[model samples]
Target: MTVHVLEPACDWRAADVADETRWTLELSPADIAELEAALACAKARAADLLDVTRDDFPLPSLAPRLVEIEAQLIDGCGFARIRGLPVERYSDDDAALIYWGIGMHLGKPWPQNKHGHLLGDVTDHGKSGADSTSRGYELGGVALPYHSDGSDLVGLMCLRKAMSGGISTVANALAIHNELVRTRPDLAALLYEPQPYDYRGEEPKGGEPFYSMPVFTEHAGRLFVRYIRPYIEASQRHPDAPRLHPKAREAFDLVDAVCADPAFNVYMDLEPGDMQFVNNYHVLHARTAYEDWPERNRKRHLKRLWLETARLTDRPEKFRNFSSHWAQKRTKSELKLDA
Candidate 1:
């Protein structure tokens, strides 16, 4: 693998507002009005899409008009917020709708919603809940390490945070990539090799427990990244999985070095009503460990969506399934795994 460095061009907007990386663009009255209109229309939409009969789609469908609104917001700020909750909030459908709708705007639908996933208090089979951590020392409320997921983009809405902690973090993948190329060419080359990744128990039917891919991939001379260290670590549990070569370990260390620096990252404390969408291939993000108050109902809960975005970066053909474009056009929750 060849190391290549491409520094960002000077831009007043990108530079002027460069503190800690959490860019906050206050919405204008028009933006807020637009949001209210979309929210109203979404509530009016009734697609039996979320009905169980439509297996892949497990959430109500928002009208095209509302979806357009979400796209505009994503293009401008990479995130948006929508307020108001259902009066009869019996299920998590409403939350699902909001997450899915925004994801549609960002990219293609990658049918995965960690369905009814429980964090601290879960009592279901296939439990990968908060128990796996040693001594019950869950990384709750601690700033989670920065990593990317297996999608073009990820949508997260701050449903509710704990009384304290749960801050979000972001790091520009491009910055980190460029740094590796400039400072450690040998390490950068190792990123081209396949690195095993755990499914976190989410995979297609009869699929292996883990799969392998480079945490760092480059296509068309551009960077395409997917890194989740914890999941990568977990994949080690499978005996058949390949071990990281020394070169891969060196690359990981170099990546870590760049992430540890503020020059490549931005941190933010998401406020209520704030929703964020990230370019998963270009950004690495994480959350700080949080404290929850079950007795008082203050728990840190976030709705997550995996999106296949309209914008296509150059990538190896394997990553792009033939139906990827079509998948982007469909409504969210249309693709569901048994999980």
Candidate 2:
């Protein structure tokens, strides 16, 4: 949905990842029906707003219904298993096209994956090497180490898959927080403190090349966590970030352990055309890397989305980029596209 008015004043506040518990809402006939209607409405509305044509875009009418599904994904039951969308019926690049359309109804598009990014399996550099964007390479290949990108929610729509070894994994951030707060309050306290983060050049013009916020925050009794340790650690490269206390390091380690726990996570094998979205602030997601047998033509490719669902929720004071005083409050400035 188009933001009615730009929220005046750039608060530049980012909210903490809240500790709201998430439950899987299974896909049902009723849910599918609702989603179809919403998607159809959102498509028409979005196309109209963009001043696009029905024939060129091939959009279905799905706005109101899309908003309903988006609300459910954000605030109601956490995550849902949705089915019967066009995504479930196709493969190849066109399936990726459908995902971009559905995502518009769900949340604001992300910067780097603005509108959408091609979710194809190609030989990108593994942890041991650099990234390659070759077509027919492993796109969305599983076995990737656990990590989260900058998005309120991530929608993954399956278009094709590797013959084997591409299971998706997700860990609940709340579970990790609860365990730490109960067993390691001292460490948890550090997470609650402001932490310095590398801007990665997303800062506003004239702003410093970095910002500070905590890995976790709490507001209205909800726990919110946002962690990309690699980025956090990179901030140290600036020579200005505060030194992490020994206790703080331990807390980070503890949180990592919880995320690795099988008990607090779920595994998914995305089917052709199935779209799955997870709350980035509440979930830590990863994939099992796979070896693609290119000779057989079985490859992995999926479309990805970074969404911002305006779920009127409270977060810890430390999360300022999304809703904090430290963040730019303009909702948007230049639409960086690279984010």
Candidate 3:
């Protein structure tokens, strides 16, 4: 098979967008006021976070900007951040409600785990990385390697910052894919073959402990990627799972090498009230390990959302709502925090 390079507009280097303005939006005072009014409207109606629709939390003015942001995520840059939400002015629940409302404007909420959490929490959950069933988001103080989540879009809204570290890192997977195809088509080609991933114990009852899907797929002349090295590595623990082919191993290593190169990745410090969103197919994200404050209120926390965007209508079948099997067990992830 002949592997072809896809030079999407999102093929940006860290230096190309290091100016921040290229990818970050500092909300204007009017924008903030508009959000406040929207929040008030949603609250007045006593809307449940999960039940809130775009109509429920109206963003009359900011809605247009969100549409452009969605375009940027899918076509231009593959990632973006909206800063200045005045989170301290509201309680934790209120802040989360606001995050959920904004997320509604971008896409439909997708379940993040077996619990079918439309909204999830990212913080220390006391799970060890060594635990086979533990997902990276549940564990803390450890670096999460570059990987894409199980959705078209993934978002995080910071409510508090850690005492140290925890900087967010995003790598241009599109650029990495094109580079691999240009220099080493043989290795890049292998990635299009099916690769096994562990279910992390989320498989339906009596189902396989692991499943297989390709890391790179092409559909309707667009490139789509679903790469999570840790999960792929963990699948090896299942005897029934297919073994990683030697060529595939080489391909995975090349992908990892490209992601680790500073030229392909950019780091961002997410302060409280900042929200970041990334197109899962075009970008792979990670984080630095960090220490947390002892006080519950001071500990780092970020509200998380896995979204299905209308802008990406041509995704491969395998990547669409892959978590629906877990949706029957719907629930949210909550952390006990100080008020």
Question: TM-scores of the models, in the given order?
Answer: 0.71, 0.65, 0.97
Candidate of highest lDDT: 3
Order the candidates by TM-score, highest first — what do you get?
3, 1, 2
Model 1 — which ten-residue stretch has the worst lDDT?
116-125
Residue-wise lDDT of candidate 2 within 187-233, one digit each (tens)? 77778787776665455567765677777665554545578665566
- Order of candidate numbers by lDDT, starting with the best: 3, 1, 2
Q: Global lDDT for candidate 2?
A: 0.53
- Which whole-number lDDT from 0 to 100 does residue 104 have in model 2? 60
Largest TM-score belongs to which candidate?
A: 3
lDDT digits (tens) for residues 1-339 of candidate 1: 566774243111223336423344344455544444554456565453232122232223333433543443333323333433321232345545544444554455554323322111211122233433221112344456778755666666655666777777776666677666777777776776788987755444577877788866767755677787777777788898898677776677677767766666666777654566666656777766666655433455555656665556455764663322223333333222112
Which scores greater on lDDT, model 1 or model 3? 3
- Considering only N, C-alpha and C atoms within 3 Å, which residue pairs clash in candidate 3? none
Clashes of each: 20, 52, 0
